[model samples]
Target: MKARILFVCLGNICRSPMAEAVMRHQVEQAGLNDRIEIDSAGTGDWHLGHPPHEGTRKLLDEHQISYQGMKARLVAESDFETFDYIVCMDTKNLRDVRELLKNAGTLESRAKVFTFMELLPDKGIADVPDPYYDGNFPFVYELVNSGCRELLKRVQADLKLA
Candidate 1:
């Protein structure tokens, strides 16, 4: 079976979706798209059914990354078991993921939950700041793009595809 990844943030209309696009791009470039799956979700329902934020779209467009048909959706307990890794944007998304897992009686999630910045061990950054509020979409994309590169490295190693 293919390994699955899920990127998560508070609203899914910004950071998470961007990360998804970035990571998917890398995976495709590696010719692993058929062996891996990527998706994204929000910790809450604030932007459910909405397309990614304009700021996010702009940054992605600048890079020619496609986020076609992506819609914001809330994270669910099922996701804990569906994805191999649940990559969150910040601490809050991690907390929300934990809460969801616990509520489902799965105290420890089957999926490995990691903060996106955790992949950038040497970058000294700890969170993928929300561009939705700060309007620093470029900065967020920079971080996510960097992390996604490292994340793809780790995934390839984990899947013994290196």
Candidate 2:
């Protein structure tokens, strides 16, 4: 069966959506699109039905990455059971997801959750910083892009789907 992955963030407008797009591109480039299902959601419903943040869309466009046909969705109760992996962008998101899945019962066992950067050798720096509150769009883009590349490698290695 195809492995299902979900990326989570505060509002699904910046970090999580960016990671989702980056990972989708990587998986398709590796010709594993059929073997992997990628999606993104927010811990809160603040951005529901909203498009990704403009800066994020622009960054992806600058990289020739298409993030069209995507919409923000809330992380549903069923997501705990549906996704094989629930990757959060930051520690706050991790806590939020943990709370959401706290009473999900056995779904907890099958749900593998972590910050996207946790797959890297660096442990403490895994949380993707929220750039919406700052003017450092370029730096945030670079950090997220680099982390996404590392995350792709880990995903490939872990699933042996490389």
Identify the candidate with maximal TM-score.
Answer: 1
lDDT comparing candidate 1 with the true structure: 0.90
Q: What local lDDT score does residue 23 receive in model 1, on the 0 to 100 scale?
A: 88
Q: Please report, in order, the local distance difference test score of every candidate based on alpha carbons.
A: 0.90, 0.82
**Candidate 2, superposed: residue stretches over 4 Å from native:** 105-107, 123-126
lDDT of 1 by residue, 1-162 (tens): 688999999989999999999888899889999988999999888889999999989989999999999999999878988999999899888888888888999688668898988888787878888877789998888898888888888888889988
What's model 1's TM-score?
0.97
Q: Each candidate's root-mean-square deviation in Å?
A: 0.9, 1.9
TM-score of each: 0.97, 0.90
Identify the leading candidate in terms of lDDT. Answer: 1
Q: Name the weakest run of 10 consecutive residues (lDDT summed) in model 2.
A: 102-111
